[model samples]
Target: MAGLWRKAPSPCIGICKRPGGICVGCGMTKADKKTFKRRRSKGERKALFRILIERLDGMGRLARWEHVYRRRCDRKDRPCPLDKL
Candidate 1:
C-alpha cells in the first residue's frame, strides 16, 4: 500500500501571472498556490493539479503549462500526472 503512495509535484511553472485572480501560467489561484505549499495530503495536491489542468485547458494554455510542468516534474524526479492523463 505504501508503494501506491506517490508524492505530488507542484504545478507551478513560475510565470505567476494573476489575471482575474487565476494564474495564467499554472492555472492556480493565489490561494491555491499558497495552499499547495502547505498541503500535506498528496490527494489534495493531486486534486488541485487536476482542477488546474482543466482550467488551463479551458483557457487554451494547457500545452504551454504541460510542457513546462513536465520539465519541472523531470527536474524533481517525479512522474508527471499530466502524462498519465
Candidate 2:
C-alpha cells in the first residue's frame, strides 16, 4: 500500500531561480521548497499552496504559474492540488 501512494506534485514548475527571497516561478523560497518536501500530508501541501497562490497573485505571476502548474500535473496524470483549493 505504501508503494501505491503517490505524493503530491511539487509547485516548482521548473523555474528555480530565486533572485530575491522568492522563486520567480512558484513564488516560494528555497526554504519553502525544503518545507514542501518535508510535508507528506495533502493538507499541509495544500495549505502552503494557498499561501503561495496569494503571493503569486499579488506579484502578477499567478496566471503563468497556474498554467504551467496545471500542465505539470497533466503530464504526471495527477490531480492539480490547486484544483482542490
Candidate 2 lDDT over 1-85, as tens digits, reads 2211235578898888787789889999988988777776666776788999998999899999999988988899877676667
Give the winner by lDDT.
2
Please identify model 2 stretches exceeding 4 Å from their true place: 1-6
Please, what are the lDDT tens digits per residue for candidate 1 over residues 1-85? 2111255577888899896999999999888877776766556666777798899999999999999888887888876676554
Backbone atom clashes (below 3 Å) for every candidate: 0, 0
Candidates in order, TM-scores: namely 0.81, 0.86
RMSD of 1: 2.4
Question: For model 2, what is the C-alpha lDDT against the true structure?
Answer: 0.80
Please report how far candidate 1 places residue 8 from its true position, in Å: 2.8
